[model samples]
Target: MDVVVLIGRILFALLFLGSGFGHLTQTDAMAAYTASKGVPAAKAGVLVSGVMLIVGGLSVLLGVWADLGSLILLVFVLPAAFLMHAFWKESDAQAKQGEMVHFNKDVALGGAALMLFAFFAHNSDLGLTITGPLFHLG
Candidate 1:
């Protein structure tokens, strides 16, 4: 379990860090890309990217508030994968035709890792509220 957690942490963390840095350092390109995808500019794209990197990377590495981090990553990645990538239009030949293909894959993988980490780590001495169900009824 510890090893699994560690591996998951590393995998998830690297992805978050890479993504965040890419978006932050390439703000002009990223913003242009986002606008191309119909996302509004004037919103601080670089700031948001930086935040995603810091928050997501830290949470995964420290395993603190990882669930929240995972959830956030999940939210960010899904539409990024489908909407931004146009996944349905891709064939094997065209799949690797653009940067969006890779970005889409990376985001999707990060989202999946986040979800798994959240689910598995839930059993690792973490506080989870169980409501409306009882193993023992008196």
Candidate 2:
């Protein structure tokens, strides 16, 4: 059961980790897309979110301050979902559908992160538990 929980955490963290890498590696492309979405300081947003995702993902993966990581993810995801995936504002059917899918995914991920924070932040029995600085090292 503990192994399963650890695996689950790793799987969940992978999404953010990959995305963070993308943001770092593809800053110019991401910043252009962000600017298209009318985001202020698009480059800065991409860079900051990239750092947040990397830090948050690593924390969750290691079960170290995962609650804080979850909170960080929630902060990044919630606003991003609305700002970036405004499906209702799209006129083209295909674009609308794509945006809707992204919006839904973002919302779901945000909810999952929130649930992780609520559960694992206080309850140690349900998921991976870390003692001291590093769980695997200890």
For candidate 2, report its TM-score: 0.91
TM-scores, one per candidate: 0.67, 0.91
The lowest-lDDT stretch of 10 consecutive residues in candidate 2 is 129-138
> Positional deviation of 101 in candidate 2, in angstroms?
0.2
Give the clashing pairs for model 2: none
lDDT for each candidate structure: 0.62, 0.86
Looking at model 1, the pairs that clash are none
What is the per-residue lDDT of model 1 for residues 93-130, given as tens digits with 9 covering 90 to 100?
66546746667686767658556555644554433322
Best by TM-score: 2
Q: For residue 111, give model 2's deviation from the true position in Å.
A: 0.5
Clashes counted in candidate 1 amount to 0
Poorly placed runs, candidate 1 (over 4 Å): 88-107, 126-138
lDDT, model 2 = 0.86
Summed backbone clashes in each candidate are: 0, 0
